[model samples]
Target: MATSVLSKSVLPKVPKTARKTSTKTAALQAQPDAHEPDANKTLNLILSRLDDMKAEETVTIDLRGKSAYSDYMIITSGRANRHVGAIAENVTKGLKESGVKSVHVEGLPNCDWVLIDSGDVIVHVFRPEVREFYNLERLWTQNPAVAAV
Candidate 1:
């Protein structure tokens, strides 16, 4: 009986230059470019969308130092469930159109309190009563030094 052995020559090798190029491309892609909007821009876009959708009692809390989850936390009130749903939808669309690759949304079915997590910003669109009950503004703005818009 004869045993067959495989040789290194049978395997295809990737070129060193190709590997280097791929590494460099991945690194470049990982870094945010000038075209990408910063946290402030994203916050502004969200605020504008909320305003366009007629969200009420809009409050923006700067959560940069306080929370690692998001740079800004926006709490706004909608007249009712439908309004809350609309506000969240508009924000999601606006953020996506502005080049946000992923925008996570929750609580859309009931719309009691819709949460839109757009990387740099977190938006909560709630019914007026729900917003009052949660009182996220008071909870988040314990420190008056943090700017609120």
Candidate 2:
């Protein structure tokens, strides 16, 4: 069967047995980083999963008005090209399974920057350099909520 995007939010306080198998993630965020970990709990759940799965730079942009694509833009980085691709694939699959319906995805072959457009959310999987060069969070800091942070 042709694959579809899956998107589902994890339920409250539930610790996933399939913990992030990445030591790097634990090192990166020893403390609870980022804002709105609860209000955007779903997005945060995805981030934690992706992070546990070795995805880096896991950021969510609240694009409630900044963009029409969705209320949030999630960005993450992979250790390498292969890792980046893997993160994108997992994210796409997860979204589809969750019934999120990934309308489109791009930049898989290169893996430098993969864009998964899943209606309400757009996921960006990028290499560290690529993420730094783009600095999406900086550009998206216009939101009052994010700006306050």
Candidate 3:
């Protein structure tokens, strides 16, 4: 005959003290996630503001020590000529508002790919074909752990 639910044998239990320690350890593990700097979050906010201003395919690559350019490379796409110009403008405005200065911007006349060189971060706003042709991620694939977001 099959055992009734109430008659089933229970597994060995963790001691009360060990259970408390495990719970505390789990809480500690959760703590770091809560207070993390969230670099991606900040990047996304900037990208959203860029998108709100119609910047497309916005991607950021963490390039720490990979190149002298900056710690991060942020790339975006602009659907058309005018959109590229607008994307540059909005990025500049947003960066300025965020207390970032000395932004060296280029490539607006053709609207092919505008590069905004901030000291610690480089933002590239590009036309789709230009971005696809260059394939920057392929060039930097050695550091794949650093995501382009």
Candidate 4:
């Protein structure tokens, strides 16, 4: 009978050839998980990773009182589809490693845009053109664009 989860997690491989048993044991036990990280820690981690990935035109819109979905929304651009996917991948990886639970990802296949939802923070990695078209920052912001008379 199959478990409720569709897929099973693959354990990290232990090198049978390794001379030291202690090293192998350490490697297996290194994967320690903690409770969900605080909001500031989570936000800082995401920002740092984006910077490391050289994401362009990054914008952080504070949605604290505005939205219940997440406390912060980070919007950034990648040079191309591949870069976008890479940025999304890095963000998700960092979140998981830091013990953020149940991170949800979408639009990875197309890579034109990827949304990573980590409960506390929402990050959007997009290609330059797609970002301009969607303009999520404008939609979320309280101030409306003033029309010329």
- Clashes found in each candidate (C-alpha, N, C closer than 3 A): 0, 10, 1, 0
TM-score of 3: 0.61
Structural similarity to truth (TM-score) of each candidate? 0.79, 0.63, 0.61, 0.72
- Give one digit per residue, the lDDT tens place, for model 2 in 31-87: 654432232544654676687678865877777766654668888889899998888
lDDT of 1: 0.85
Off by over 4 Å in 1: 1-4, 7-23, 33-35, 143-149
lDDT of each: 0.85, 0.72, 0.72, 0.88
Q: Ten residues in a row with the worst lDDT in model 1?
A: 1-10
Candidate 3 lDDT tens digits, 54-130: 77666777776566556777878889878888888887777666656466889978889888876667778878999
Q: How much is 141 displaced in model 1, in angstroms?
A: 1.1
Ranking by lDDT: 4, 1, 2, 3
Lowest summed lDDT window (length 10), candidate 4: 140-149
| Root-mean-square deviation per candidate | 4.5, 18.4, 16.8, 12.8
Best by lDDT: 4
Number of the top TM-score candidate:
1
For model 2, which pairs clash?
5-95, 5-96, 6-94, 6-95, 6-96, 6-97, 6-98, 7-95, 7-98, 20-52
Q: Give the winner by lDDT: 1 or 2.
A: 1
Model 4 compared with the native: what TM-score? 0.72
Query: Could you tell which candidate, 2 or 3, scores higher by lDDT?
Result: 2
Per-residue accuracy of model 4 over 28-64 as CA lDDT, tens digit each: 6786555779788999999999999999999998877
Error of 2 at 8 (Å): 52
Model 2 local distance difference test score = 0.72
